[model samples]
Target chain A: MNTTRRSFLKLMGVSAVGLSLGQLGFDLAEAQAYASKLKIEGAKEVGSVCPFCSVCCQIIAYVRNGKLVSTEGDPDFPVNEGALCAKGAALFSMYTNPHRLTKPLYRAPFSDKWVEKDWDWTLNQIARRVKDTRDKDMVLKNEKGQTVNRVDTLFMMGTSHASNEECAVIHQAIRSLGMVQMDHQARV
Target chain B: MPKAFLVDTTRCTACRGCQLACKEWHDLPANATKQRGSHQNPPDLNPNNLKIVRFNERMTKEGVVVWNFFPDQCRHCITPVCVDVADMAVPGAMIKDKKTGAVLATEKSAKLSPADAKAVAEACPYNIPRIDPKTKRITKCDMCFDRVSAGMQPICVKTCPTGTMVFGEREEVLAVAQKRLAFAKERFPKAHLVDMEDVSVIYLLAEEKEHYYEYAGFM
Candidate 1:
């Protein structure tokens, strides 16, 4: 084996405890008890992409017993090089955020509270609103008598959370609805 | 062969990735915090937060507004006074790991009285080691001994986006600190390493300690 001095020193560092607080006449039994097994010891690492911002840094998700044990940035990735920003670092919490909306919430026009609604009901309401707004505000022609085919009042706001493919589909869907004023949340 | 940390403050952008990563790795619960006009949340280190990115802002005599970020944690001192103080009250309360030179607080620290616990915390030069109100035990950064034992870097060091924190063998880390200090001195003439000789975790401060934190270094 090609063991250099540096590698040998690292091996020595890992394998031996030259001096401890115990040798200094302090009991380390309690501190030893504090050294529990690593949480990701037996976990399986699965590579995934971070779902934040334009820089989709690769992440290693540690899964144990089919559940996510932990997550961190992948060291091999060139973009982030194992480094994560504040939002990327908090990926675990973002996954397990209790306040995250899993179900659609709907609040009536005059209501003060939002009640849980099914996806079908939510989608139907959205479609109806979009159609009504498009019908009311569609500008088919300008003063120059040229077809514009645009809706003035309707606007589409894209989310940074969406993947590239999803953004493309969203763009097409909004364009088909004659929406012109489109902006992305990521741009802000 | 002991491990050490080089915290290059010049590279830190106050993103708080290290702080959040520490909390995530330890599975520590979040503290309820409000906007205190500064990005430094929860104010200071507590039971839940073993590490925090301290933010300090001051205007120089030249009318330049300078903002500094200090990622504060237990220095894991070479001759930890916290261990001495804690050992006086509770023998097994704190221990220094031989191989990594990591100063760790144990569950046995709960045996200490409020006065003894406060004394242990007060003994730290960097003002680390907070006593948990509920557990009545000392709490501070443990240098991620479990992770280090598994041949992995500490969460704070691993998650630092700005390359502010570097963890490795003592000699190599000291070299890195010195190199970073020399580079920082070119830009900030007052650049220096804070108490490098006394602690396993060395911080390369680009400016005076007064512009960082009151307890940024030993008195």
Candidate 2:
């Protein structure tokens, strides 16, 4: 009877579709085929710092064949001692998030939408704007006749995420531009 | 000896490091979230979120609003009615690890019918189990069995900056829980440890359990 049923199924071309009793039901074969692979199995660990706060918690970023696979707090770091806050723990997501901007986005005044600009164009546009703004709003001296070579229009916003060296470099650059309204995101 | 955890809610500042670390160690994906006028995001635990910090607010007798945060997860009950229920429906569906007292859902749990899985979920007093629609498997906190077996603490406990959560041998953890309970009671007068005798994970609540979360403890 089994042979006859098999022959009948063969004649009807149902066997071609793998419609046998054991095969007809739910098949985990497809799912299991992709289950053995690990997302970060062979990744290399690169030490870095969490760019969120002053703690500067060290983190280990796992890279697989030049691509970042994951990140976590470094257990060896004494400051955080393998712990991270909400913002620090989200470093992986911050890098791999779909909302992250790959290129610079520029939104002009009174513009409703942002336009993507290349690195060269963005840098040149920024330089042109900074030069024009400083040239237009330069305040070399106050009413009290103090030598305050400051640009009131151009506000330099510093990032809390910057390292000490990076902050120093940024401070020198901004100071060279004679921009006095310097503020850090930590205060905000 | 079995292992246990003592989560002192009083020391928890709602930093949510434990919650994120659990997700990171588990390799769980991010949840789409929106502002709910509260710090608690994604609302509640789903298939991806094994742990969550629940926020609750209440008025004191003096008419002052008191905000409370409860880091909620599986209690790993000693009796574990969910295990019994799951076993009756699908053998080997759920198993309690003898070494760590971790109630874990094995891979064989995929064989459980939806009704049986729902039954097991309902049997849980803490509402810890969540079914994944894509995989048709129920998942929750496993107490990091792989890490624990390798002599490492659970990721959530290791990543807790506030030292609110602690994991150790069952007896040692219970002793710590009792000590903290005594210290807390001296100050709050209403401090209590939730289900300390019945579960592997004991939570020390400063006020009533209701002020922390609805299912903070089993009565």
Pick the TM-score winner.
Answer: 1
lDDT of 1 by residue, B1-219 (tens): 589999999999999989988888888888999988999997999999999999999888999999999999999999999999988988878888777899988888999989999999998989999999998888999988877865678999999988899999999999999899999999999999999889999999988898899999984
Q: Model 2 reaches what TM-score against the true structure? A: 0.81
Candidate 1: give the clashing pairs. Answer: none
Q: lDDT at A178 for candidate 2?
A: 88
Q: How would you encode candidate 1's per-residue C-alpha lDDT over A1-188 as one tens digit per residue? A: 89854355346545434444355233556655565467876678788888878778888898999999889888878888788888888888877889988999988989999999999999999989988998998889999999999998987888876778998999999899898898887687
Off-target runs (Cα >4 Å) in candidate 2 are: A1-42, A53-56, A108-111, A135-148, B30-38
**Residue-level lDDT tens digits of model 2 in A1-188:** 55653245234343223333223222334223212233444467789998778678889888988998777777778888778888887788788789988999989899999999999999998899999999998888999999899898899888866878999999999998889888877787
Candidate-wise lDDT, in order? 0.86, 0.81
What lDDT is reached at residue B169 by model 2?
A: 95
- Judged by DockQ cut-offs, is candidate 1 incorrect, acceptable, medium or high? acceptable
Candidates 1 onward: DockQ, in order:
0.40, 0.14
Q: In model 1 chain B, where is the ten-residue run with the lowest total lDDT?
A: B144-153
Error of 1 at A48 (Å): 4.5
